[model samples]
Target: MSSPPDPEDLTARARIRDAAMRHFGEHGFEKATIRGIAETAGVSSGLVRHHFGSKEALHAACDEYVLRTVRKLNEETWAAIKEGDLAKASATRRPSGRYHRYVARSLIDGGASELFDEMVGMSEAWFTGFVKGDGEPDVPVRDRAAVVTAWGLAIPILFEHLSRAFGVDLSTPEGDIRLASALLDIYSHPMMSPEEAAAARAGLERAARRSTTEGTST
Candidate 1:
C-alpha cells in the first residue's frame, strides 16, 4: 500500500552507499565525512544518516562492499588456478595492478580512496594467506614459495596494466614486474641465520641509501 517503499528511494540509498565508498576509499576513514558523501550523492545529510545510522555504519558498509568485490575476484582466480591456467589466474587475481585503475577512477571521479585502501589491504592479506598455504601443514614450503613468487610477479604486472588503463604513467609495467620478482625471490629464500639476517639488513640499508642518493641526483 506504501508503493513498495518507493523504488526511487532505494535507488538513492544505493547511490549514497556507492558515493560513500568512493569518498572513504580516496580520503580514508578518518577524513571522509558524512556530509561530504551526502553532498556528493546528491542527498540530504539527514537522509544519509537515516539510512546508515552513523559514519561508522557507513564505513562498515563500505568495507563489506570491498570485501565482496575481493571475494568475487578471488573466486575467479581460484577457478582459473584449479584449471592449471596460471595466466588466467593471474589475470583474474591481480587486483592491485589491473583493478587499481578502476579504484583510482573511483577516487578521482567519485572520491573513494578509503574504500580502495581497504580493498587493497584485504587483497594483500588474501595473497599472503595463499602464500602461506592457509595453515595446511602438509603443504610443502617449496610449493608455497612458488605460489608467493607468482603472486608477487603478478601484482606489479597488473599494476602496470592498471596504470595504463587509467592513463597514469606512474611506473612502467615491466618495472613493476621486475620489482615484484625481486621481492618474491627474497620471500622464497630459506630462513636466514641471525647473522645472515643482520647482514641482509645492512645490505638493504646500503641499497636504500644508494637509491636515495640516486633519486636526489636525478
Candidate 2:
C-alpha cells in the first residue's frame, strides 16, 4: 500500500516539460540532452523519463501543448466572431511568443517535422472552416494560408535580426503590439486595384507557361 504520488510531484512534471521545451528551443531537439533538461528543471534524468517515458514522447507532449493553446485561442476568437465583434475576436487571438525562439531554432535545425506539419494542418483546417462552408480548402486558399502562417507568424519569430533592424524586440509585449499593428495596417488596406490584380495574374500565368515550356524542352 504505497501512497499515491504527491500533487507537487505532478506539478514538477509540468516544470520538466517547460524546461525541456526551452532546451529544445535553445539547443535543438537532437542537441538537447535528457540529462541537461532534467538538470535545468531541477529533476533527475530518471524522474524525467519516469514522467515522460522518452525524449520523443516528451517532444510530442510539447507539440500537443502548443496545439491545444492555439486551439483555445481559436475557440475564443471564434466565439467573439459569432457575437459579431470582429475587433474583439481579433484581439482575443494572441499566442504567447515565449516559445518563439524555440520554434525558430527548430525551423533552422530542420527537425521537429511532426510538430511543424501538425501546426500547419491545424491552421489550414481552422481557416478552411471559416470559409463559406465546411469543405476542404481549394489550392489557392490552402497555399495562401500556409504562406501566411510561415511568413506572418513563424518568420518574424525566426529572424530576430529583423527586430534590431526594425528597432523593436518582437519577443516583448510592446514590440509584439507594434508588430501586430503594422501587420494589421497592411492586411486592412488593399495594396492593388482589380486591374493590377488581373495584370499580376497574367504575369504569373506567363511565368508558369515559360517554366513548363523550358521543362519540356529539356
Which stretches of candidate 1 lie above 4 Å from their native place? 1-10, 94-218
CA lDDT, every model vs. true structure = 0.61, 0.71
Query: Per-residue CA lDDT of candidate 1, range 1-218, in tens?
Result: 00122254368777887788667655766788999999999999999999899998986676565556666666677667567775565455444343343354444444444654544554555555554532344344455445554453344336566556556543545444444355557867757776796798789999999999999999
Q: Model 2: number of clashes?
A: 1
Alpha-carbon runs more than 4 Å astray in model 2: 1-10, 81-95, 121-139
How far does residue 189 in candidate 2 sit from its true spot (Å)? 1.7
Per-residue C-alpha lDDT of model 2 across residues 103-154, encoded as one tens digit per residue: 6776677755765666567667666665353344435666766676677556
Candidate 2 whole-model C-alpha lDDT, 0 to 1: 0.71
User: Candidate 2, 97: how far from true, in Å?
Assistant: 1.2
Best by lDDT: 2
